[model samples]
Target: MTKLSPETILQHACIGVMGLDNNGIIQYINPRAQELLVCDTHNGISLDTIAPQIWKQVKTLIQQGMNEQAIHIQGPRGGIEMVVSPVDKKAKTSSDNFNGVVCFLRSHEKFESSAWQYPTIKEMHLQFQSLLDHSYYGIYIIDGNGIVLRVNDVAAGLIGMTKEEMVGMPIGELAEKGIVDQALSPAILKSKKPLTRPLYVVKSNKYIMASGMPIFDKKGDIRFVVVIEHDMTIVKELRDQLKHARQVADTIKNELSDRNLLELKSHEVIADSPAMNQLLTVLLKLAKMDASNILITGESGTGKGFLSKFVHQNGSRKDKPFISINCAALPDMLLEAELFGYEKGAFTGASNTGKAGLFELANNGTIFLDEIGDMPFPIQAKLLKCLDDGEIRRLGGTKSIKVDCIVIAATNHNLEKQVQQKKFRQDLYFRLNIFPVHIPPLRERREDILKICDFYLKRYNKAYNQKKRFSEKCIEQLQGYHFPGNVRELKNIIKNAVVIKENNVLDTVLPPGKNKAVPISPPCEETAAPPASKGLNEEILAFEREKLTQALNHCTSTRILADYLGVSQSTVVRKLKRHGLSVE
Candidate 1:
């Protein structure tokens, strides 16, 4: 039998085959190789014309007599793996010492065997290096010690570092310097599984999404970690932009809704008592007129804020802003500045571009002045003027800005008593008294207790992740009890009960039986007796004044006062005149 030539042997090989020269030009390509590579060029084609990536790495390999285990080159139809081996031209012919390399190409997708054949170590290394260098993702190969062995161009560019600088660098050192956090790589090695984390590349000021997988050795121990990274900076920026856009849209929606019209509404207040239901009907009727100023009288934390919101939300100007401020919270000066915005530099540290006051912010809307009794005496006069004239001047500006805001003031104080004592202006008191809404205390509406209890119990159960039930005994006990804090107190009791009780019945968090509410305000001096003076006449007068004031509270009539004090009617009238008490 005639011995087969090298070309004949290669052409007959089962896998694809290619041979190149020292100048990186393709010398020979078998039918299998052409079919796998799908190259358009024939005999005279350079390796670069067929596959640029393979040419780039394979040329260096041939020059150094380096070989690769396997490499995957892509084409339109399929992917081919190339295993390279050095070709000895000197042994074949003396004319050339280095002919090039013979690459054995195999299609991964067209494998006939169930098990894959491992390529030689040299071929494997070249294949891996080629794939890693040209990948779009940033790739890092790390050893068990967390030292980077190799990196791709994409990875280096993300950190603003060259591959030369990163290779052999410890991942811990990179993290310490804020280049990219490789903490997940360590976890992958520990768990022998893949891990992913979002990282901020401080050096490049960009966000990266990184995933890492552990590569195990023969002993099933993690030998190295391969981390792949993708840029997420644009996605994060878009998310923030979306959040801000939603906020702006919500503001515009609120601004444009229900403008300048406060539609009449009934039963906005949550109430079951006859008094409350009747009061709500009247309140809605007055709100429909939209001409009268309103004064809401109720204890602190008695759903006053909720009622204020209801008034604004259900009224003609319901679509407009309902601005509320606590009159007692700030000092006189700060309250003035907040109520009426100052001109630029009106006071030390004032805003350079004068601010708009709550009243201004509430223009064409409703401004609820809370704790109105606590407002300073001077502000009260200015407030009265503003209410009467429909205009207000800033703290320092001479110009009075015309405003059409509806004023709704609320207080627990007895403004009628304040007016009689001269602490509150009489005219302002009368102006606010129009369409008065006097919310009854909880003790007067015992029927609402169970309804209010169920409402708050359901609310707090959802909040605290509880399903506590109120026993019949518990319900009766709560209903019988006087809630001085009213709706606010009931809400707190239920809230605490939900947290404390583990069983179906909430009996642990019930409040003490004492019904008196804690006083929200200090006693006005008008009710206090005159203090004793140094003189005998002053001491006698103080005693008389104390007796008269005490009597005045219960018995306003001189005839009744005389009967209660065991004194004559003329004597009672004489004492009333002397002490400046009314004797109607």
Candidate 2:
């Protein structure tokens, strides 16, 4: 018999694994289980005798050659989720003859408490009190009878009720009493199913967003309903701000009508550091090549989207279409339709005429998938197919459409870490990891901070028609700031500073002394005054080399050094080569 490839390595995994023959006799047991169960498969043991609750599900999955869902089984050592798939090394057909079952077990020690019994209110509270208390989202729970079994402090405070006052009160009674708005706990109880949201409750003039799920018993009967609620006070305020913004939106819209939005939106990267200079140089090189799939990784608001557009505009496909989509902005179904396009009548609300997808529209150009990490698993699989065959099959379409396009994906997520946790696919990660570029955070590339700040300052001044300027002390203070939000944050700070102040020197907003605690690095002098030890030219060259050496430790690549030195990247390369400097 052939050894299951994954199972051989999974054999030593901490989670127990067991194999059963077609006749329900144990043929193999991994080391973890051997120690736990105190038995070897040499002595055939029936799984039915060991875990009667799980054997039924296992037997069905093995016979069918696959299982779509994991089966959670409770045992002496808490609970373990079992995933079963057919072990076939050579079969080409989807149907594989089942010789034996290889079952992988995943431990669920903490989750076990929830999977098991909901004994008494006190026990329930004891089992989950710590979790509920520590969670930022308010937690409320009800029993099958709709009796409020538990309400954490956060939940109680949201409704102006104490745990004692809320407990034992039927949710229906509470809803009728109008203590808070109607709860979704009742819907979960009525349907005996999980629910995502409930009608907003108006208590203390605050709208509460609530969602819950119904827990079940061994017999699959409704046992308890747990809901998490969040106060949307700040969110409502932001919404109000949006409404006010719309009041002046028309003036801005009319102003933009005569201007090229893309041209206006386009921002030139400010590279006054080695890190950024090298990045810009490489970006241009990649743009010229224009065929390879590129992945840009960075923190949010670090100009990843901007860099991608820059690449497309500079590329061979500059005249062609450039399409972009945020993978996270739409739901899975909508995102899929938007990317691959769906045929007319494909679903209940699909377009009358099949709409062309971004991939098709971006043919011969570039398609930017922003926040690609949030893409749905199904879409990821389809994208892999498209990348492989250079053809995409629209939803409910029989024919595949060929597309010649550059795929550039950007994300703030650690895709490699996501793959390890099984949240992301390893194959897809490897495909995207090819030609990877990581944009450094603004804090790390501090040399570029002032340049970016000044760019935004000048632009905002032009837009607002105010000639406000930052004092030298203000610049120094800004440089000292950690700028945790990076360039994006710096831009906002500059805009706010200019708008709130009308004076020529908008310095007092930050207060020069506020950032004194953070050490300012010698006032960021690009070039120092000539020393008397040698002639001016020699002193300047010596100073330039010293700056390069100092920046070399902070800047990893030639591009960064070039940006830091305020020179063309080629010049930095030539200088480095002359100085016998080399990098991997």
TM-score of each: 0.43, 0.43
lDDT of each: 0.75, 0.74
Q: Give the count of colliding residue pairs in each prediction.
A: 15, 13
> What is the lDDT, from 0 to 100, of the residue 387 in candidate 1?
92
Error of 1 at 503 (Å): 2.2
Off by over 4 Å in 1: 1-268, 512-584
Model 1 per-residue lDDT at 310 = 66
User: For residues 1-584, what per-residue lDDT tens digits would candidate 1 score against the true structure?
Assistant: 99999878887887888877766688888988887767656887898877777788776666555544466667546776678766773443331355577788888676524223545655777788888888888999999888999999998887789999999988777777757654667677677889889988888988889899888888988889999988888899999899999999988765544232222222224577888767666665566667458899876446665676766765799888888887765568988999988999899989899988888999989998877877888999989999999988998898999988878888877898888988888999998888788887776777777777887787778887889889877876777665556676677778778878778686545655433233332322224334555697678888999988888889857667866765434346556767877644
Worst 10 residues of 2 by lDDT: 521-530
Report RMSD (Å) for each prediction in the order shown.
22.8, 35.1
> What's model 1's overall lDDT?
0.75
